[model samples]
Structures are given as C-alpha cells and as structure tokens.
Target: MRYSPNHKLETKEKLLESSSVSAKKSGFATVGVDGLMKAIGLSGGAFYSHFSSKDELFAAIVERELCQSLARLGGHGEQDCARLERCLKHYLSMAHVEQPESGCALPALGAEIARSDILVRQQAEIWICRLQESWARILDSDSLAWAILSQCIGALVVARMLATADIQRTVLQSSQEEIGRQIAGRQQAICK
Candidate 1:
C-alpha cells in the first residue's frame, strides 16, 4: 500500500492530539507509550517512527497544550479588561473544574510538568509567561496578573481535590469572588 507524503505528518498530529487528551485526563507518567499509541490506533513500535522517545512526545504535548491555553486565555490583540473579566469567569466556572481532560492543561498536568526535564518545563514557562503578560497588559499590573493566574490554577487544583460538587463549587466561587474584588479594587485605586 502506498501512503501520501502527508500521511506521516498527519499521523503524528493525530497521535499528539490523542496522547495529549489522555495525558491530561490521566497523568502523563501513568500512560505508557503503548497505551498512547493504542489510543491513536497505532502499534507501540510505530510510536518510535513519530517520536524518538516518549519524552519527546511529552515535550510536543506540552507545547501544543500551552499554545492552546495561551490562545484561549490570552486575547489575540487589543483585548480589554472586560474580555479579561469574562475569561476569568469562564476559567473559574464549574464546567472547567469538572472537565480536566478538555480544560486547561496547567491544572491537569502541572505536577507532571514540574517533574519533567528542564526542556519541557522551560516550554511550559514560556507559554505561562505569555499568558501572564496578556493579563498584565489588560490589568495594568504585573503582580495582579500573576496573582490571579496563580489563584485560578490553584483554585482548579483545590476544587478538583475535593470529593463533593458543592464544596468544589464553594472553592471556585470564593476564588472568583476574591479575584473579582482584586480587579475592582485595582480599578478603584486607579480612579483615586
């Protein structure tokens, strides 16, 4: 059977997409190479054809996920404070909390990213910083941007750790409220 030249690139793209979802839904370390390949309807050995090693695949996933996160939370250009507010609301909602697989990769895979090699972590940091910068530009305070970003990610982590939906909702609501206050206060301070 003959395959188009794009077939290899297309297969790698599919593998990355499937593996990323699996890694975020579960832990990256928990899912083996064979499992990742199987998720994309490929054999374990075929994984080597796409990636030199599992670590390489992980690096790719980090880049892909973070790029997505940047696009979602970070406005393309000329974003306003209102857009940032809407983003914070959506990011801290129950839907995001319940859907780890489809949600932000940071809260889902932060621990794994922390444990990975320097290269992977460096890639994550770049995207994270871009997100922070986007928020900072809109908020007009770098520290405020960092605080809200950390709180949002931490809120998701804490909310997911709990067993009950009500308590999870409480955590998310409190964080959002506090963040809203912070933003409002910043605006008031600017007016004063």
Candidate 2:
C-alpha cells in the first residue's frame, strides 16, 4: 500500500516524538530501533525508511529535544532576573527530576551524547551554546551564566543519582538557593 506524502511525514513525526521521549526517559543507547518502532506501531523495518541509522535518528532526536528544551526553559521575552529565576525554579524542582522523559535533555542524556558520534555530539554542543547565550543575556555575565548552567546540569545529574527522594530534593534545593544567591549578589552590585 502506497501511503501519501503527508501520511508518511505524519508517521515520521510520530516516530521522532515517541522515540525522543523514550530516549530522554531512558538513555538513547538503551532503546533499540525495534522497540522504538513497536512503540509507534510501526515495523522494525520501517525504521530505515525514516533514518539511515540509529545514529542519524539520535542526531535528529538531539536536535528536536534540545530546541524544545530551549523554548521551554530559555525564557524568551521575560526580564533578565525573572527569566533566570523562573528557569532555576522549574529546572531544579523535584517534578523535573522525577519526570525525566519530559524534562531537560542535558541531565537526562548528556552521558550518552558524550559517547555518540561527531554528528550527535555536535548537535548537543550547538544547543548547549544556545542555552548558555540565553542565560548569559539574562544574567548579564557570560561567566556567571556558564557557572549557573554548569551547576544546574550537575545538580540535576547528581540529584537523579541519589537513592532517596529527600536527598534528591536537598541537592536541587541547595543548588537552586545557591544560584539564586549568586544572581541576587550580582543584581545588588549593579544597583550599588
């Protein structure tokens, strides 16, 4: 049966969406093409139709996930401090940590990307730079933005590794407060 171009496009989008969420929730390397295809009600052979290889699919997923994450967390039009604060609150919350599939891609899949091919890693680098620039604009200091980004990503990674919810919350709360203090300190200096 020959599917229309629109139908094929729709199917491909569905596969990308589902595969992205699954990869974020569980490391991309761990999700097999067969299982990902099955999740979207497509045969394993259909995977090749959308992507030449798993690496290609992974590159696409990285690009999609990172763009979505930036839109959600980058705080496009809000004031600088407010945007930074909002991002910190949402990113460091227990809810974000608990729902890896729907959360930021950095903490969820950073390790896997580090091990992936140049194409995938390049995609990750592009998004990371975009995020840093977004934060830098709000924070008014590229150094501080880099620090906050590093801290936020590291905190999430550590929080997720802990055994208990209480520990995870502690890690998140501490990082959030610390970042907040840094921002506040900078603002105060600017006001003085």
Quick one: best lDDT, which candidate? Answer: 1
Candidate 1 accuracy as TM-score: 0.97
Per-candidate total of colliding backbone pairs: 0, 0
Tens-digit lDDT string for candidate 2 (17-73): 998899888888887889999999989999998899999998998999999988876
Clashing pairs in 1: none
Q: What TM-score, over all chains together, does every model reach?
A: 0.97, 0.95
lDDT of 1 by residue, 72-182 (tens): 999977887777888889999899988888989999999999999999999999999999999988888999999999999999999999999999999999998999899
- C-alpha lDDT values of all predictions: 0.92, 0.89
Give me the runs in candidate 1 sitting further than 4 Å from their true place.
Answer: none
How many pairs in model 2 have backbone atoms within 3 A of each other, for residues 3 or more apart or on separate chains, i.e. clashes?
A: 0
Instruction: List the pairs of residues colliding in candidate 2.
Output: none
RMSD of each: 0.9, 1.3
